[model samples]
Target: MSKPVYLGKLTLFWCSSCKVPVLDGKCACGQKTEKMTITPPGDIRPAFPYDVNRINEVSRKQFGADMIRPDEIVLYNKAPYEDRMEEIICGGVILGTIRFETEKTEWVLMPRIEGARRICNTKTFTPEKMKSGELKNLIVLNDDAVPYVAEGTSVLVPGIYDVSDNISAEDEVIIITKKGEVVAAGRAKMSSEEMRNEPRGKAAKLRWKGTPADETSPEYRDDAESGFFSAPRTWDDVIAANRNILDTFERRSIDFIRNTAGNMDKRVTCSYSGGKDSLVTLCLTNKALDDFDILFSDTGLEFDETLENVRKVAEIYGKPFRTTSAGNAFWEGWEINGPPSVDNRWCNKMCKLTPITALIEDNYAENGCLTFIGQRKYESLARAKSERVWRSQAVPNQIGAAPIQDWTALHVWLYIFREKLPYNPLYEKGFDRIGCWLCPAASLADFMNLRITHPAYMAGLDEKLRPYAEDKGNPEEWIRYGFWRFGKLPPFMQHIAEAKGIITGNPAADAPAEKTGE
Candidate 1:
């Protein structure tokens, strides 16, 4: 499954005439306005459970330790559609974003400027921080070269004053004036030591420059204070505020289920995965239909908690529970497929789709079955544009329907809570979504949480990947860093490996056979 990529927050520009949030400086009435930070009433959810430490680590590594408050709540607002973009909101304002890039890396997208000056940006700190030696990745400009380094201009080697000795080429850096004012945030063209010594060359390629504006304006002050932290304190609070919307959603979904079932000539069943989405679907399905079966594809790689939840939910609903097993299929196919990566997910086919197809064929081959799934548009682009009910070419004899296709993660969570349903314990244990214990699609943050919650599972994964790493001429660190999860190393990982002078070999060459727990 493709993960949601958080691009960043929507830039809020206030129209003075309109007195409301506008997408840009121009209002519908053609009135130009200034940027303002206004905390809008909305849901503030964790990007991931263990993301707090990761966010702090990024802040500390980029700026300095104790720069951002440890107690500050870090939340995310997802972008519309399946773009995989989320705006990182804090204190009721968009601070930055945790973006899942196409390269299989999550990037922090911070604002370039608060108003007229560059105060801070994600991965790049302010010039004051650089002068205080708080920011290690920095390029100090020469005294005579301040005028030339505008918002759009590049920093040249000839005008360089000082550079951090630890700075590497391609590192994100803050270019600052001698007086400690930030000029721009950019990528270093050359290493810090090399840039300082080189007579003539580009030092840093600017991404965003400091704009000329009135920093002392009241708009700027208001913008600074606006943040997402001022939103609802808890999920319950959020749900309570949107109770009417939830009611409408529940009514619509129940109606959809009834209408779809009324039109279908086959038996009704719900595809339950024991995850939040699926659990919601199961609940809605029960509300819509008097009698329906629950079809669960037990991939065998599922967490024990998930398996137990599935049984519990089925028993609670008094529904006929049927399960299909992909027993050891994922492990057996590992030798041929290597490891499942974000780009290559053969495991899903072997463990999920294949078993689901067989289960349908054996049970409902004559008339087929209409399966209500817990698919949401927020999950991916493909699902976003998907029809409310459709037949998949991949899975024959099965018609799929998603009642909560328009719902968001927040909505699903709220509904689950409102219904007083017993959700999977994995979510309480810091898992946002439940799936295979060692799913490669999971973020590094998720993996860290998994390590803390299920050390044995992680250790088992490490053991499995160890031989593959060794066979591929990669160190144990390859498995340790979760490099084995990707079929191809992302640019970020490639940079780290290259900096360490580690040459990674192809795992496809002389691949080892799958071990039978020997």
Candidate 2:
């Protein structure tokens, strides 16, 4: 976690002509692209309809409008944070970022002008010009305040701001000049009523400073001024935009598989995870070689949909299908090592590696199969720096190769959509990354969604977890806030737990519960 993960020399680009993101400088439409300044490790992903809706829902709550239109194609780059945060991209410019605050279980929008302008209008009420109630977070400052705020200074009360009726202390506000230019976006230190009545404190703590002159894109600036963003589009439009790039990338991946298969001294096999990445890898492997097996490791906790997808993929490819299961190992490990946490994933050794290692040793002996995994660099720092072809020191018998190591999530998804592959329905249902149902690495938002959609599974997990929290605090609060995921609570979590009287200190190290519940 200490080491920074960079996606290497590769940088992400936004294609204005195609209305989508492209991996290279030149877009499929033969138009030059704008380089996106995304935060590292820049493993950006296309925001799905579900993700889009959720973001818009958050924006609507704060700004009284949706920052991203459902019809617009948008991409999100993950940012460093305690919980979930993503930098939203649209119209070849940064719209803003939307993040989930773990303590509040709330989604907050940290807008740039591209996003703030969509929901805010800085007009005063005239017969021809009127301020909409929907533009409720606006703070208009006098002429004296504009230049100072433009310099990234916080809005001071002495500037004599005229604030919107809905402005409340701690509410996110869009600071604009009397002339209607957006100056900054910040959190309110004083409510609208307080700002009007009082005279000597910071009015708003500015988080993002904005000036039209600071932006390089004249077209984007024009669009912002005229409100020209968010035209109607579909997923098909996205695919069409990246069609040329996809075909070229596909050919390269196919060639990689062929070369890796041809050179391997042992048998070549494709590992299937029933995820979009693996699906593309399997398709490439099928095209690359005539003889190979599709291997799957069922870790007892896998969803039935995932299991079905595995079977369907193998059947479609007309390849040999082989699977091994660690049927009761996870449950047994739970009794010994406790539930798997982000820091300590004892579950991986038991459920995946042990079964796979055993299968590789028994079937292929010493010179193990050359397994092609659907590994992508953008997934993590380690994976980003990982070599395409290598052997894990832990499982030296097996040789692993990644054909799509450089692919972004968008690349994998577009490939899946173009090929009309039978992907897991869970993605459409809002599961972005497919894995075990109870993966601790997932945010609390994921589990809350599961509580409603998969009640039986959630209820089962809660039953096991509730008993452990009985002596700690309100069992319901502990579960509701996702206190069970951490073996050692991070500082932010520790702060929340202490405030809630959930526990006096880190509970995991304090005492070990006999049996456990990620």
Candidate 3:
């Protein structure tokens, strides 16, 4: 069979020495000028000519009529569609018309329909540019330096020495500079620890370009000694830093609670997870407001320590703490629907949303209420894009306010410091989130930490997932995928890792565990 011939525009160079197309790997122009080739979609000239309407119908069925943008065009061969191209076509193609969203539009030469001829392609076009932003509140590294980063600066690898919290991909974030100037901001391509540890690749893809520092927005004004990066330390320093952090946190937290109470309706509560964020949020919320409720959604997959911690937090706060489970119904739901994917997360619906919705419906009983959340904009891009206060369309008549929406991870820790709030033991042991024992959002390092610190929890995860893996007829893929994801199998199950040891050490699979405890 003949090799598949790629039909496209061929460059012909008229060399004074050898007048011909630039063929045979040599240019006719004794000067040896290089030639380039370009191809457009859809074979204009084909041996097997099919109806144009059929192609249009298929394209429309697969992609919406607007699948291809007006600014773009499509390319195709005789073969079936390429998967990558299919995505691009659906997301980025148009017809022969090219539109320009930016200035500096220019004209270029396009190949004529036949005979290697060229014509002036009177088209104006622009490349796609995406923008994002983050807000940076001044955070003190020590007694010395106060740093400021703005809402829209690229977070490079070298800029960050330590992370403030357990942020995930696609979460909104606020960026502050080491010198106290808020830099540019955008969605994080990687997490906080991922930015600190990963040596290569673009750490956070900058959405909005930052304004340069000037007299109005000074650059690097903070004293070097005061900055936290000035003195990096091991686990032992956490206790010493507590005093400084707590002092600052207590005052701000009190203010935050008061402001939240004043701004929202009577019904407010904390989204308690027994982790550092929610714990701090609960303590601070209670301090500021009177008779606020705490809602704890038991995903039915929480670590034993997390459950205990919930009890402890509730007892200490002296507030009514409620528990709602995913129940057998959720388990049965998963059985019918199969596992949830990254985009399609029904678990959040079954476990997190349903319980909260039920509670609001039963307790509020048609009364208008407001809920306070511990969500910080720095947690993710989706969160960052959100407003500080918004009405929940899902839950009618309830307003949601994230009092600490603009705060950074470091700020949360500062609250823990000043108030001397009781935190989940897992934070000391290096677990960032203390929700479900096997949360899909955890990083690889988080999973491994679970293995070393909480082996029994790992065992539970393995047992729970085993049946699902078997039902899928690809037990190995299922086991290996979730194991390396967040919930680590116990050390005893190291053989499981060894048996199908093919997948490990991947950034997608694991990261270096953050050291929080001795």
lDDT to native, each model = 0.66, 0.77, 0.45
Residue 8 lDDT in model 2? 56
Better of 1 and 2 by lDDT: 2
State, as a TM-score between 0 and 1, how close model 3 is to the true structure: 0.46
Estimate the overall C-alpha local distance difference test score of candidate 2.
0.77
Model 3, residue 284: displacement in angstroms?
1.9
Candidate 1 C-alpha error for residue 220, in Å: 2.4
TM-score for all models, in order of appearance: 0.69, 0.89, 0.46
Q: What RMSD, rounded to one decimal, does every model reach?
A: 7.3, 3.7, 26.7
Lowest lDDT 10-mer window, candidate 1?
Answer: 114-123
RMSD of 2: 3.7
| Residue ranges of candidate 3 with Cα displaced over 4 Å | 1-253, 263-265, 463-478, 483-518
Ranked by lDDT from best down, the candidates are 2, 1, 3
Using lDDT as the measure, which candidate wins? Answer: 2
lDDT of 2 by residue, 2-107 (tens): 5555765445786766666777788778899888787777776778888889878877777666777767888888877887788888877778888878777777
The window of 10 residues in a row where model 3 has the poorest summed lDDT is 115-124
lDDT of 1 at 54: 59
Q: After superposition, how far is residue 186 of candidate 2 from its true place, in Å?
A: 1.7
Best by TM-score: 2
